[model samples]
Target: MNQYLNHLHVLRLLVQRELSSRYKGTIIGILWLFLQPLIMVIVYSFVFSVIMKVRIPGMDSSYHFALYLMAAMMPFFAFQEALISASNSLFANSSLLHKSTLPAILLPLVPMLATVITETIALVIIVIAAYLLLDQVSYYLLLLPFLVLIRLCLSLALGYVLAIMSVFVQDLRQALGLILTVILFITPIFYPVDMIPTELIPVNNLNPLYHLLDAYRAIIIRAELPGIGLLYMAGFSILLLCASVYFFQKTIERAKEFI
Candidate 1:
């Protein structure tokens, strides 16, 4: 009980430090967090809606592209940013490997928790804008908190494994950039899953990120419950989380020597 209490106290401080330091000394301050998503949304809207003249079937409006992109991009930006930061967490704090008294798992989790909080705040602005611009809001928006929780779990699970691996294979940093780029294009963030060939459905479903991005769209845009796939995603993430910790623990002794 005492150890659990101490862990909570330390995690609280670490999250605070991570959040504050993240935006510190920036010219735009916290607005910096929203900037990247904002730019992506604009670029996608212009290229897809304006140039390509693409139309999402159920959505009929001048701003449908913006709405479509916003719904999918919100959680995705959070997932991508959080995962990247969390994956690099161990390396960023390599010096603290032997020196820190707190649990090492807390290292990746700090960025995960910090990104959740920051993105939640930034998301509110995007949601409000979409509601105003489209004049369409669903009661299903109420379920978004639950969906966001699932996204957080999935991000943390993949992040911990990568964070540990990156310590041994420094090449992961460069390779991760290319991999995430391919994932972005393949994950249906800029397009709809219905466009995917029927043969590809199973492969796409296996991505886990596909489930998350699709769930966000389903709840916010489609205004429906996330499919049963989310249950599978939640299960996979928990198992992955367990395995990652075991792997990290077994390898941690050797990892410290390298660091």
Candidate 2:
């Protein structure tokens, strides 16, 4: 427990440093936190609902398509930001890695936690606006914590593994960015899974992220129970966590030399 607390202390310092460096000379500064996602929601709303005219049938709630999109987007943005940030985390903090003797595993976690914390605050405002605009909040809203937990676990697991590999191969960051972009669209963030062709359903369902967002959609927009598949999602997250930590611990010693 003491060691865990020490890691938390180290994580806090790293988070503070990253936030400062990220917005150091910017004029608007942290305002970007709210603006970036808001802007994305707007752009996506325009492209998907307006231009593309994609239709989601089950979302007959008072919440419009925009609200539905934003609901799913909160976690997706967090996942994407955390994954990308975590991938480059070690490389970004090379100075700290070389000069400091803190737990090396905590390096990737700093950005993952920072992104999750900042995004969670932003999600609160978005959720309130969504509920107010749509109608009374649904009971499924309670599942939010579970959804967020799943996202964090998945991001951290993937981030830790990537961060360790990045020290050896700098180009992995670029490759990961491209892969994540493809995964984002492939995931049901902008569209509903039901719209997917029946034959292709299996392929799309293969992405664990699909089930994660579906769980949120069930509780928030649909006002229904999270499907039994959430157990599968939880299992997937646990497996990833085990694999990532194992790889990170084994490879971190070599990462120290490369950094």
Q: TM-scores of the models, in the given order?
A: 0.89, 0.87
- Please report, in order, the local distance difference test score of every candidate based on alpha carbons: 0.78, 0.78
For 1-259, candidate 1 gives per-residue lDDT tens digits of 9999999998999888887788899888767667766676567667766787778777786467776777777777788888789768887887666787878878888989887886676566556656776665778778778777888888877887788788889888768878887888999887788989999998998888888777777766666788988789888888887888788778777777777
Error of 2 at 119 (Å): 2.4
Q: How many backbone clashes does candidate 1 have?
A: 0
Superposition TM-score, candidate 1 onto the true structure: 0.89
Highest TM-score scorer: 1
Candidate 2: what lDDT? 0.78
Residue 73 error, candidate 1, Å: 1.9
lDDT of 2 by residue, 197-217 (tens): 999999887888888888876
Model 2 ranges off by over 4 Å: 1-4, 38-55, 58-63
Clashing pairs in 1: none
